[model samples]
Target: MLVASLTAVGAQEGPSGITQRTVFAPFDPTQRGCHKPPGLTKELAYVQENEREFLQGVNHGLEMAAKDRGLKYLRSVAENNVPKAVEDINAYQAAKVGALVATSSDPTAVSSSLQRTIWSGAFVGTIVPPPATLLLNAPQYATGKALADASINYIKSQLGGKAKVVLLTQDTMEYLTPRFEAMRDAFAKTPGVTIVADIAPTPVNKEGGFVTMSTVLLANPDIDVVLGGDAVVLGALKALRVAGKDRPNQFLGGIDGEPEAVSEIKKGNSPFKASISLSSPVFGYAMGQFAADWLDGKSIPQAMDILPIALTSENMAQYEADLENPAAVYADPIRKSTYLKMYGNICYDTRDQYVNFPWSSESSK
Candidate 1:
């Protein structure tokens, strides 16, 4: 029998005010893995570091999960290197680690290697981008649309539906491209919304965003809106301030509710407005729990969703509260439900159900 920790979170509400995108698969927690538990020297390796506060949350979740499972934990940073990610997995495999958690590592790049890890008899869990024993994702289209709706509302209510916009994107990510595309679609329908520049920075960081926006400012000096990941958008905020373009009418927003973005939103008058945050720590902890489950020969969810919440000054406090104490917040029937969606189970007997490519929770919807 599966023991209930706290209480079962029924259907939870996401930032979109609908069902929170959290999903998981049913597992018999009472079971244990076929492989012998790792000896004293072995560890459970977390494949990559998710940088920034968002990923810091993930790191903490993994840590908390490790502590809860009483597993020696190891972590390495790939810094986005596919080969390094694979090597790290192999290193853990060689050590005969009981399980692995790959956080936001490229699924396409690491799919073959992850599959091999499973073949080597190790349990795996993946987040955001995945193809592992356990997977979590938000519906990309919905993710994009949610952010677009936020921007559209701001454009109409604040900017009067007329503004010069700059879109900084990690366009190389196929799943995330919809965010930019949705913004474009919304802008197309609204008159007086001119896209000043839509560009991808080389490094996809704050500095890169600053450099790119500085150049874009050379021609489009009147940019009043900016959209993209928080790192890039925050960089653009710096550029706009230096250029003396951070005006009251200007609006800025992005996904990945970095702390900086939240601070900006709290400013009340700053152009930095909204962010779509997937509570990495909360979901990461859930992922860790799932990882522990998989290692114990328990069935695990093949896929789940960490739904994004659009954070503004108004809702920042409550969200922060949830983040600060994810366990307590998740203990709540409602919030917990949003973060824990269960699907069909996967066990050693169902290893074929282990995902090895880009899997979408939307498919099960």
Candidate 2:
């Protein structure tokens, strides 16, 4: 009877346990750093350096999270620029290991790569849908639209039907158009909220930047509130400052919490009324936690998990401190320390014995 029971148990086990690996391939922005690689033009080098700094900051946060959660993480680089991301994805998929790709690059490239490689995987394709919820700091367009609507409504109630608002975004037309439409619909019934303009341009492109900024400023001189969809708002703020525009009188809000933006606010020269920050390090920790759970046979929530919160002046310090010490943020110093101490050595054997069945049973027996 014991032999029969053992056989039944083994049969039930089947391939239930996960044995593969999880990989992270971030879009390379090495060219965006100040240490320009040889043979690159000065202009190209600066762009690369800027991109590199942003991406490195993101990776630092992600790495801290992974370390705190005892996740076996590997970083792959797509060195041939945006186009090379697809090649990296193909290579990762060919290895037949599960992966969680992250990026701070153009969404078009990231989406295309995901569709061709990760999503089209012979075994398990993409983990998340197109436009990847991972980008834009978790609060995807739908959520962003809702928040914008609420904010706009509040403005309308306060203004009493005499406010003109302009929506500004650095996203390409293909990305921002739909959200613009949604915002339009959301404000259709609200009074005193006129969307004077919807400007969607490649913020970093020299020619595009000049044309878009000129057009928006010329067309909407009387615009009251400026709603920014992305970090490009920072560029807009800088431009507005140069033009001697009064920011406090003209409300400004955006979706990103870039460090520079925080600095500007701290200096009391910012027109930014509010912003939603993804708390990059905190996000990294969450990803790490999910990765650890998935690896340990604990069912992971759907890939499209709702991101936590937005940060504002009121609570930015708390979030910043948490990024510095995720253990304190996670509220379990011992567990966090253990996970960090183990780092790349984390494995089934190192997992807490209390969480393992045979060990727990044996201890009890």
Residue range 1-365, candidate 1, lDDT tens digits: 21111111122211111123333445444554443323313356787744667777877777787778777778888877777887777666656676788754566666655555555556677765555667777666566667777877878897777778898988888767766777788778878788889889878989998999999999999887898889999999999999997797678888878888888899898988888888877877777776676566566666677777888888888888877767665457688666556554665445555665556666445
lDDT of 2 by residue, 1-365 (tens): 00111111112211111122222222221222121112211110000112433345445654665566654445655543665655554454334333344452544455443333222211111212232212222324553565466457547664565667766654454433444555666667777678777767564433443355456777665655666643555666655665665456455656545676566545544566555554545445544554444343333222222232444567767656765665465457543332221111112122111011101001111
Per-candidate TM-scores read: 0.83, 0.60
Q: Report the lDDT of model 1 for residue 363.
A: 47
Model 1 whole-model lDDT (C-alpha atoms):
0.71
In model 1, the runs with Cα more than 4 Å from the true position are 1-43, 80-83, 103-109, 339-342, 363-365
Q: How many clashing pairs does model 2 include?
A: 9
Model 2 misplaced stretches (Cα beyond 4 Å): 1-58, 69-72, 77-80, 90-99, 104-142, 146-161, 170-179, 203-211, 308-310, 326-365
| CA lDDT scores, all candidates in order | 0.71, 0.43
Prediction RMSDs, each to the true structure: 8.6, 14.4
